[model samples]
Target chain A: MNERQRARRPGGRSARVAAEVHQAVTDLISERGYGNFTVGDVAARAGVADSSIYRRWGNLETLLSDVALTRLNAQSPMPDTGTLAGDLRTYAAQVACEITGPDGLLLVRLAVALSTNGQQGLQARDELRDERTRQLQSMLDRARERGEQAPDALGVLDHILAPMYIRVLFGIGPLTPDYVDGLVDRLL
Target chain B: MNERQRARRPGGRSARVAAEVHQAVTDLISERGYGNFTVGDVAARAGVADSSIYRRWGNLETLLSDVALTRLNAQSPMPDTGTLAGDLRTYAAQVACEITGPDGLLLVRLAVALSTNGQQGLQARDELRDERTRQLQSMLDRARERGEQAPDALGVLDHILAPMYIRVLFGIGPLTPDYVDGLVDRLL
Candidate 1:
């Protein structure tokens, strides 16, 4: 292996442990939709010592929050199509696919439900929003600079996002690509 | 006093009982949201016999759903204005006030969280939606007949309602009169 490659090698033993736990969180949430899984369940599935998780996250809810935060922070960068209409349609469609699906929707609901119970919940939710806000603001700013969107389009992302979430809340499903296209067209 | 009035008086006893229970449900939900109040608690607050509640509504979730449905069904008729825009604005604003408040948002979350548990949650949510669909269809039909809205504009009510819920989800309170006005104006 090259010297540079060797430098990045080995996230090491703790890293392996963390990676396993992360996969377990995703697996369990995907299976149960977030309302029922417990920390001990994650511990057994990850094959990590229960003490390892307890030392790091303290509880199931915080660990879930960490997993969610990590996913959001590591989300793929927004697509950059040439036109504002194309960019927004692509972005909105991606979001519809993400949140309308059973697993993705549960993650968000978990965050909201968690926040109602305590401070860690609020912290995780706020952190996620901060990360998202930065991502959204950057996308909109680019649109404005390209003269593709109106100057005032800066704050309009939430308006577009609102409908997709409503769709999830009411259990409206499979959010057809055509219907999401309509939402983009209308909001634009 | 009068014979016709005396004939309507027999509803006095049972109707009073129903009204008391309804008020108790509202009070408890408003006080602590809907995740925790018990059937016994509701009975005590209603000052009606526990047997009466059990005879009418088998469970707390079902009883809560019934209360929400009755209130929604008994809601005042939509306002009529000279223009479709005016009518929509007035109607949308009214809905904004109703759901954006603390109690309204909790009621919705309760249905969603309950749905995680079993069938009663789904039934309650479905009943609320059916009533809303009927109401929205009628209003949109009137607008279409007047040529204020296109025939296809029928399904757009959800898009309009979506933002208000998002606002409530994040605890963004007082969904300002102006903000809701902006939503209607933009969607239209």
Candidate 2:
């Protein structure tokens, strides 16, 4: 292999294995809950050998952290709809889709639960959260640039974002499409 | 026995047992997680008779629902500190304390998981959530009566309340005293 190709080969294979194992971890947690399994169980489920998991991770908590962080870090690309209401509606709809569904909802709760176990556990989660905030801020700034008097990030999240999450997390109420549109209208 | 005295006795004893079992469920779930246990395990941990738990709750899911709803229903009296700022500061501090502890945090996630399992499970939780809304609405109304320009229930909860929960649930970022004050100030 050429020098560049040789350098890239190991990473490509390991990335595939890591992706498989990480997806396995979340799927198992969502489907089966995280209390019952062993590393061997995860290895079997991921189709990676136990020795490889050991060689790569060596620690259970580290492996779990990697899974948790990887899931949290996967931000979908935001759709640009040009108009303020349309942009927010798209954003809200996307978010609603995200924190719902059986597995999706469970994973969000699991992410929260695991992240709060300690300060160290919270650090990477915090960074991911900041990234989300930045995304929101950028969206709002674009609205402002377009002459829309958009609400501040904290305000929008508190009034608009948090309610949706609370509803999903607790089954406390509904988060219908009309509701999303109304929030965007009010905020705009 | 007199009617009043006779009416109260069974309830008093049963009430105590119910509390014990409910506490036991949360404690066990927090300590050992929600899987790999039975009514007997909860009973053993609670030091109550297994027959009592079975007699009262009927099935494991019912017992789980009762615990989830009970915690949701147990809202502390919100302090009226004569101004919106003081009132919210007190409120926010209490919430931060409630959702941050090991058991408190676990119970929030447990509430979400159990509530979403079926329609019957969500009913009691939905009621409790409404009561919380009413409580916040009442607080807002009183603020209006006192001529403080407070946001309505929907606004307060959506913008003001949800952020606190978001922070607690995901370890997204810090929910410090200063942060709470900022949220309250922004909302006001």
Candidate 3:
């Protein structure tokens, strides 16, 4: 099989192994907490040798970081509606949905686990933030080029999007569509 | 001793115990990962019984949540200035200072760990957010009453403050006073 096909196949050995490993890690984390799971547990659960897992991820932090970031970044990009409000509404809706989804739960758990690690957690967090900011910035840049945004488009974007994440992070108010619309309208 | 005196005594028995426990948890989390630290380790390091920690916090999750929330809540309230911009600048400066301070490090670490736990971290997180939001809301409310703020003062508050927390949580950019001022000028 070609690379793409091999990667997709449920029956393929490598695909099965990777899936098993991912599921094992996820389950272990949820059941045992981030402070309890070990590399050996992951290897045994995945039925792979410990060396194989180590060679792939180098360390547990790197492995979990990859898992968390990949899941978060896998979402599709925001659609452009040629208007700032339209674009923000679409972006906010997608983000809100994700925040209430399984991926959001995983991210919350990961945040708590990383909160005590100082530099290690901060480094991983910076990378995650950079990725999201770059995506948001690119969208804002396009809006500016089209003359469809205000002079403070970046500031507007931060105002509009930041609250949704905060609400999700803090488990405060609902991230409803109406809330997103109100936010976009006011900022725009 | 009075409650105030007990709280202020840096070298008191309770203070020393808390310090030792915090350090132990921090070191274990950094060296062996959050999943590796155990109640036994924490208790032994604190020179207290495991039952004592459990009686106080109930579980590892609850204990960590309390630790994280307490640190964030202990942050000083925003200073009042006649202008919204001035108040925001002061608030942002304080936020930046705290995030860069030792207590800020502890809070950030906890935030990362809590990110993946979903609802597990919501109670503590919500308490912190609600307290800050109330302070900001009151400021905006006063501004509105004084005709200094626009009709949608709450919107302005969210727009200004949400982004700061987002930047801090994600580590996307510096939470400098200038950045806060720019945000206030644009959004407010």
User: Chain B TM-score of all predictions, in order?
Assistant: 0.75, 0.74, 0.62
User: What value does DockQ give for candidate 2?
Assistant: 0.53
Q: Per-residue alpha-carbon lDDT of model 1 for B26-76, expressed as tens digits?
A: 899767656667888999998877888887687777788778778765553
Regions of candidate 1 where Cα sits further than 4 Å from its true position:
A1-10, A20-63, A72-77, A81-83, A118-120, A144-147, A150-156, B1-11, B27-61, B70-77, B144-147, B150-156, B171-174
Flag clash pairs in model 2.
A158-B158, A158-B159, A159-B158, A159-B159
Interface RMSD of each: 2.5, 2.1, 4.1
Query: Model 2: which docking level applies?
Result: medium
TM-score of each: 0.73, 0.75, 0.68
Model 2 residue A114 lDDT score? 55
lDDT of each: 0.68, 0.69, 0.65
Candidate 3 docks at the CAPRI level of acceptable
- lDDT of model 3 at position A95: 71
**Model 1 compared with the native: what TM-score?**
0.73
Report the lDDT tens digits of candidate 3 across residue range A1-188.
68757656777776677677888888887677775778899999888999877866776766677667666566647577887667777877777788777556465456545554567765665565566567777777788788875535456447666677656655556777788788777767
The deviation in Å at residue A88 for candidate 3 is 3.6
The top-ranked prediction according to lDDT is: 2
Model 1: how many Å of interface RMSD?
2.5
